[model samples]
Target: MRRVIMLRALVWSVLLFVVSFGCAQERDPIVRIQANALSKAFFVGDLKDPTDDPEFYLRATVVDVASGAGSDGLFTNSDAQPTVRVRFEITEDMLLARLTYERID
Candidate 1:
Protein backbone atom coordinates (compact mmCIF):
# COMPACT_ATOMS: atom_id res chain seq x y z
CA MET A 1 0.00 0.00 0.00
CA ARG A 2 2.80 2.40 0.85
CA ARG A 3 4.59 1.75 -2.45
CA VAL A 4 1.40 2.23 -4.42
CA ILE A 5 0.64 5.57 -2.71
CA MET A 6 4.17 6.82 -3.19
CA LEU A 7 4.12 5.90 -6.86
CA ARG A 8 0.77 7.59 -7.34
CA ALA A 9 2.00 10.74 -5.58
CA LEU A 10 5.12 10.84 -7.73
CA VAL A 11 3.10 10.42 -10.90
CA TRP A 12 0.69 13.12 -9.82
CA SER A 13 3.52 15.48 -9.00
CA VAL A 14 5.16 14.86 -12.37
CA LEU A 15 1.89 15.37 -14.16
CA LEU A 16 1.30 18.62 -12.31
CA PHE A 17 4.80 19.79 -13.07
CA VAL A 18 4.43 19.00 -16.75
CA VAL A 19 1.12 20.81 -16.97
CA SER A 20 2.47 23.87 -15.16
CA PHE A 21 5.58 23.97 -17.27
CA GLY A 22 3.65 23.62 -20.48
CA CYS A 23 1.35 26.46 -19.49
CA ALA A 24 4.23 28.69 -18.47
CA GLN A 25 4.12 32.13 -19.98
CA GLU A 26 6.72 32.85 -22.59
CA ARG A 27 8.91 35.92 -22.34
CA ASP A 28 7.96 38.74 -24.66
CA PRO A 29 10.04 39.18 -27.81
CA ILE A 30 13.02 41.51 -27.70
CA VAL A 31 12.35 45.01 -29.04
CA ARG A 32 15.21 46.69 -30.82
CA ILE A 33 14.75 50.44 -31.14
CA GLN A 34 16.17 51.54 -34.41
CA ALA A 35 15.21 55.04 -33.34
CA ASN A 36 14.10 56.31 -29.94
CA ALA A 37 10.45 57.28 -29.99
CA LEU A 38 10.38 59.08 -26.64
CA SER A 39 13.19 61.46 -27.45
CA LYS A 40 11.54 62.24 -30.69
CA ALA A 41 8.28 62.80 -28.92
CA PHE A 42 9.88 65.08 -26.34
CA PHE A 43 11.95 67.07 -28.81
CA VAL A 44 9.33 67.19 -31.48
CA GLY A 45 6.59 67.60 -28.82
CA ASP A 46 4.54 65.24 -30.90
CA LEU A 47 4.72 61.74 -32.23
CA LYS A 48 6.23 61.64 -35.66
CA ASP A 49 5.43 58.70 -37.84
CA PRO A 50 8.81 57.63 -39.04
CA THR A 51 7.32 55.33 -41.59
CA ASP A 52 10.29 55.97 -43.75
CA ASP A 53 12.91 54.55 -41.38
CA PRO A 54 12.00 53.42 -37.87
CA GLU A 55 15.46 52.13 -36.97
CA PHE A 56 17.00 55.45 -37.81
CA TYR A 57 14.24 57.46 -36.18
CA LEU A 58 14.12 55.26 -33.09
CA ARG A 59 17.86 55.26 -32.68
CA ALA A 60 17.83 59.02 -32.76
CA THR A 61 15.10 59.41 -30.15
CA VAL A 62 16.04 56.48 -27.93
CA VAL A 63 16.31 58.50 -24.71
CA ASP A 64 14.92 55.65 -22.59
CA VAL A 65 12.28 53.14 -23.48
CA ALA A 66 10.74 50.78 -20.92
CA SER A 67 9.53 47.20 -21.43
CA GLY A 68 6.04 45.90 -20.81
CA ALA A 69 3.66 43.35 -22.31
CA GLY A 70 1.40 44.80 -24.97
CA SER A 71 -0.20 43.52 -28.14
CA ASP A 72 0.75 45.15 -31.44
CA GLY A 73 -2.37 43.96 -33.13
CA LEU A 74 -4.17 47.11 -31.96
CA PHE A 75 -2.50 49.22 -34.62
CA THR A 76 -1.40 48.68 -38.19
CA ASN A 77 1.95 46.90 -38.73
CA SER A 78 3.00 49.07 -41.64
CA ASP A 79 5.63 51.16 -39.78
CA ALA A 80 7.81 48.57 -38.06
CA GLN A 81 8.48 45.69 -40.42
CA PRO A 82 8.28 42.26 -38.79
CA THR A 83 7.42 44.06 -35.53
CA VAL A 84 4.05 42.81 -34.50
CA ARG A 85 4.35 44.65 -31.17
CA VAL A 86 6.68 46.97 -29.22
CA ARG A 87 7.35 47.20 -25.47
CA PHE A 88 8.14 50.70 -24.39
CA GLU A 89 7.51 53.53 -21.88
CA ILE A 90 8.36 57.20 -21.34
CA THR A 91 9.97 58.16 -18.04
CA GLU A 92 9.58 61.38 -16.02
CA ASP A 93 13.13 62.38 -16.92
CA MET A 94 12.04 62.56 -20.54
CA LEU A 95 13.46 59.21 -21.51
CA LEU A 96 12.11 56.76 -24.03
CA ALA A 97 12.78 53.08 -23.49
CA ARG A 98 12.50 50.62 -26.33
CA LEU A 99 12.99 47.48 -24.33
CA THR A 100 11.49 44.80 -26.57
CA TYR A 101 10.85 44.69 -30.28
CA GLU A 102 8.75 41.81 -31.48
CA ARG A 103 8.31 40.50 -34.98
CA ILE A 104 4.99 39.42 -36.36
CA ASP A 105 6.44 36.13 -37.41
Candidate 2:
Protein backbone atom coordinates (compact mmCIF):
# COMPACT_ATOMS: atom_id res chain seq x y z
CA MET A 1 0.00 0.00 0.00
CA ARG A 2 2.78 2.46 0.88
CA ARG A 3 4.65 1.82 -2.40
CA VAL A 4 1.50 2.21 -4.45
CA ILE A 5 0.69 5.56 -2.83
CA MET A 6 4.23 6.90 -3.44
CA LEU A 7 4.17 5.83 -7.11
CA ARG A 8 0.85 7.57 -7.69
CA ALA A 9 2.16 10.78 -6.13
CA LEU A 10 5.28 10.66 -8.29
CA VAL A 11 3.26 10.15 -11.46
CA TRP A 12 1.01 13.11 -10.64
CA SER A 13 3.99 15.35 -9.89
CA VAL A 14 5.65 14.51 -13.21
CA LEU A 15 2.46 15.13 -15.11
CA LEU A 16 2.02 18.56 -13.51
CA PHE A 17 5.58 19.57 -14.32
CA VAL A 18 5.22 18.58 -17.95
CA VAL A 19 1.96 20.50 -18.33
CA SER A 20 3.43 23.68 -16.81
CA PHE A 21 6.46 23.56 -19.11
CA GLY A 22 4.30 23.14 -22.20
CA CYS A 23 2.17 26.11 -21.23
CA ALA A 24 5.27 28.26 -20.75
CA GLN A 25 6.47 27.49 -24.29
CA GLU A 26 3.19 28.51 -25.95
CA ARG A 27 3.42 32.20 -24.96
CA ASP A 28 3.09 34.51 -27.96
CA PRO A 29 5.00 37.74 -28.52
CA ILE A 30 3.42 41.12 -27.79
CA VAL A 31 5.05 44.33 -28.98
CA ARG A 32 4.11 47.86 -27.92
CA ILE A 33 4.94 51.05 -29.76
CA GLN A 34 4.11 54.73 -29.77
CA ALA A 35 2.26 55.61 -32.99
CA ASN A 36 1.98 59.36 -33.08
CA ALA A 37 1.31 61.50 -36.14
CA LEU A 38 4.97 61.76 -36.99
CA SER A 39 5.95 58.19 -36.09
CA LYS A 40 3.25 56.23 -37.86
CA ALA A 41 5.51 53.75 -39.61
CA PHE A 42 7.03 50.97 -37.50
CA PHE A 43 8.19 47.40 -37.80
CA VAL A 44 8.82 44.28 -35.82
CA GLY A 45 12.50 43.83 -35.28
CA ASP A 46 14.35 40.67 -34.26
CA LEU A 47 12.34 38.71 -31.73
CA LYS A 48 13.92 37.14 -28.70
CA ASP A 49 12.88 33.69 -29.85
CA PRO A 50 13.19 33.72 -33.61
CA THR A 51 11.20 31.23 -35.71
CA ASP A 52 11.60 30.02 -39.28
CA ASP A 53 7.94 30.71 -40.10
CA PRO A 54 7.59 32.56 -43.39
CA GLU A 55 4.53 34.66 -42.51
CA PHE A 56 2.84 35.97 -39.39
CA TYR A 57 -0.55 37.36 -38.27
CA LEU A 58 -0.90 40.35 -36.01
CA ARG A 59 -3.65 41.74 -33.78
CA ALA A 60 -3.33 45.40 -32.88
CA THR A 61 -5.12 47.89 -30.64
CA VAL A 62 -4.87 51.64 -30.59
CA VAL A 63 -5.38 53.76 -27.51
CA ASP A 64 -6.17 57.46 -27.41
CA VAL A 65 -3.21 59.54 -26.37
CA ALA A 66 -5.05 62.04 -24.23
CA SER A 67 -7.95 60.27 -22.52
CA GLY A 68 -6.42 56.77 -22.34
CA ALA A 69 -9.38 55.27 -24.20
CA GLY A 70 -8.49 52.31 -26.36
CA SER A 71 -9.98 50.51 -29.37
CA ASP A 72 -9.15 47.47 -31.46
CA GLY A 73 -7.82 48.73 -34.80
CA LEU A 74 -4.85 50.20 -36.56
CA PHE A 75 -3.37 53.58 -35.76
CA THR A 76 -4.92 56.63 -37.37
CA ASN A 77 -4.52 60.42 -37.37
CA SER A 78 -7.69 60.68 -35.30
CA ASP A 79 -5.63 60.32 -32.15
CA ALA A 80 -2.95 62.88 -31.50
CA GLN A 81 -0.36 60.47 -30.12
CA PRO A 82 -1.74 57.06 -29.39
CA THR A 83 -0.21 53.92 -27.97
CA VAL A 84 -0.32 50.83 -30.15
CA ARG A 85 -0.31 47.30 -28.81
CA VAL A 86 0.60 44.57 -31.27
CA ARG A 87 0.47 40.84 -30.70
CA PHE A 88 1.70 38.52 -33.41
CA GLU A 89 1.73 34.79 -34.16
CA ILE A 90 3.60 32.79 -36.70
CA THR A 91 1.47 31.42 -39.53
CA GLU A 92 1.86 29.65 -42.85
CA ASP A 93 -0.19 31.84 -45.23
CA MET A 94 -1.55 34.84 -43.32
CA LEU A 95 0.56 37.88 -44.14
CA LEU A 96 0.62 40.92 -41.90
CA ALA A 97 2.10 44.38 -42.46
CA ARG A 98 5.30 44.64 -44.42
CA LEU A 99 8.29 46.37 -42.88
CA THR A 100 9.05 49.33 -45.14
CA TYR A 101 10.68 51.76 -42.75
CA GLU A 102 14.23 50.87 -41.79
CA ARG A 103 15.00 50.68 -38.08
CA ILE A 104 18.54 51.43 -36.95
CA ASP A 105 19.23 49.83 -33.60
Candidate 3:
Protein backbone atom coordinates (compact mmCIF):
# COMPACT_ATOMS: atom_id res chain seq x y z
CA MET A 1 0.00 0.00 0.00
CA ARG A 2 2.78 2.42 0.86
CA ARG A 3 4.68 1.63 -2.36
CA VAL A 4 1.60 2.21 -4.48
CA ILE A 5 0.99 5.55 -2.78
CA MET A 6 4.58 6.61 -3.41
CA LEU A 7 4.41 5.63 -7.10
CA ARG A 8 1.23 7.56 -7.60
CA ALA A 9 2.74 10.61 -5.93
CA LEU A 10 5.75 10.45 -8.19
CA VAL A 11 3.63 10.29 -11.33
CA TRP A 12 1.53 13.24 -10.22
CA SER A 13 4.63 15.29 -9.46
CA VAL A 14 6.13 14.70 -12.89
CA LEU A 15 2.86 15.55 -14.61
CA LEU A 16 2.57 18.76 -12.62
CA PHE A 17 6.08 19.85 -13.56
CA VAL A 18 5.52 19.22 -17.26
CA VAL A 19 2.19 21.02 -17.24
CA SER A 20 3.61 24.08 -15.47
CA PHE A 21 6.68 24.45 -17.67
CA GLY A 22 6.14 22.97 -21.12
CA CYS A 23 2.58 24.18 -21.77
CA ALA A 24 3.27 27.78 -20.71
CA GLN A 25 6.02 28.65 -23.18
CA GLU A 26 5.79 32.13 -24.73
CA ARG A 27 6.75 32.06 -28.40
CA ASP A 28 4.24 34.37 -30.06
CA PRO A 29 5.48 35.33 -33.51
CA ILE A 30 4.28 37.98 -35.96
CA VAL A 31 0.74 39.40 -35.87
CA ARG A 32 0.09 40.73 -39.37
CA ILE A 33 0.85 39.49 -42.83
CA GLN A 34 -0.56 41.82 -45.51
CA ALA A 35 -0.26 41.54 -49.29
CA ASN A 36 1.48 38.19 -49.22
CA ALA A 37 3.27 39.34 -46.04
CA LEU A 38 3.04 39.08 -42.29
CA SER A 39 1.92 41.42 -39.50
CA LYS A 40 3.87 43.14 -36.76
CA ALA A 41 3.14 42.02 -33.27
CA PHE A 42 1.80 44.39 -30.65
CA PHE A 43 1.07 41.58 -28.20
CA VAL A 44 0.32 37.85 -28.09
CA GLY A 45 -2.76 36.30 -26.64
CA ASP A 46 -2.94 33.44 -24.16
CA LEU A 47 -2.38 29.83 -25.29
CA LYS A 48 -5.42 27.60 -25.35
CA ASP A 49 -5.17 23.87 -24.72
CA PRO A 50 -7.00 21.31 -26.82
CA THR A 51 -10.52 20.45 -25.70
CA ASP A 52 -11.89 17.50 -27.66
CA ASP A 53 -8.47 16.62 -29.01
CA PRO A 54 -6.47 17.12 -25.87
CA GLU A 55 -3.71 14.85 -27.02
CA PHE A 56 -3.28 16.54 -30.39
CA TYR A 57 -3.50 20.33 -30.63
CA LEU A 58 -2.32 23.43 -28.86
CA ARG A 59 -4.24 26.50 -30.07
CA ALA A 60 -3.14 30.15 -29.96
CA THR A 61 -4.24 33.45 -31.49
CA VAL A 62 -2.18 36.31 -32.83
CA VAL A 63 -3.59 39.81 -33.23
CA ASP A 64 -3.00 41.49 -36.57
CA VAL A 65 -1.47 44.94 -36.34
CA ALA A 66 -3.03 46.47 -39.45
CA SER A 67 -6.62 45.29 -39.12
CA GLY A 68 -6.68 44.40 -35.41
CA ALA A 69 -7.87 40.99 -36.54
CA GLY A 70 -7.01 37.77 -34.78
CA SER A 71 -5.54 34.81 -36.57
CA ASP A 72 -5.93 31.50 -34.80
CA GLY A 73 -3.26 28.88 -35.33
CA LEU A 74 -2.70 25.40 -34.04
CA PHE A 75 0.59 24.13 -32.67
CA THR A 76 0.98 20.40 -32.52
CA ASN A 77 3.52 18.37 -30.65
CA SER A 78 2.65 15.33 -32.73
CA ASP A 79 5.27 13.82 -35.00
CA ALA A 80 2.72 13.53 -37.83
CA GLN A 81 2.36 17.31 -37.98
CA PRO A 82 5.16 19.73 -38.71
CA THR A 83 7.40 20.19 -35.73
CA VAL A 84 6.56 23.30 -33.75
CA ARG A 85 10.25 24.24 -33.40
CA VAL A 86 10.73 25.00 -37.10
CA ARG A 87 7.12 26.06 -37.82
CA PHE A 88 6.41 28.26 -34.81
CA GLU A 89 6.78 31.53 -36.70
CA ILE A 90 3.64 32.67 -38.43
CA THR A 91 5.14 34.77 -41.21
CA GLU A 92 2.28 34.48 -43.69
CA ASP A 93 -1.25 35.81 -43.67
CA MET A 94 -3.20 32.63 -43.07
CA LEU A 95 -6.45 34.30 -42.12
CA LEU A 96 -8.57 31.76 -43.96
CA ALA A 97 -6.68 28.59 -43.09
CA ARG A 98 -9.00 25.60 -43.05
CA LEU A 99 -9.21 23.32 -40.07
CA THR A 100 -7.09 20.39 -41.06
CA TYR A 101 -7.12 18.54 -37.79
CA GLU A 102 -10.25 16.91 -36.44
CA ARG A 103 -11.20 15.15 -33.25
CA ILE A 104 -9.91 11.58 -33.23
CA ASP A 105 -12.24 10.30 -30.59
The superposed Cα distance between candidate 2 and the true structure at residue 89, in angstroms, equals 35
Error of 2 at 75 (Å): 32
Candidate order (lDDT): 1, 2, 3
Task: Evaluate all candidate structures by whole-model CA lDDT and list the values in order.
Answer: 0.52, 0.51, 0.44
| Model 2 Cα shift for residue 55 (angstroms) | 37
Clash counts for the predictions, in order: 18, 0, 5
- Give the range of the ten consecutive residues with the poorest summed lDDT in model 2: 37-46
| Top-scoring candidate (lDDT) | 1
lDDT of 3 by residue, 21-55 (tens): 97887889976646755222211122232232212
RMSD of each: 19.2, 15.3, 23.1
Alpha-carbon TM-score of each model against the true structure: 0.30, 0.30, 0.25
Please write out the lDDT profile of model 1 over residues 48-67, one tens digit for every residue. 44333233233322233347
* Candidate 3 CA-lDDT value: 0.44
Model 3 steric clash pairs: 32-38, 32-39, 33-37, 33-38, 33-39
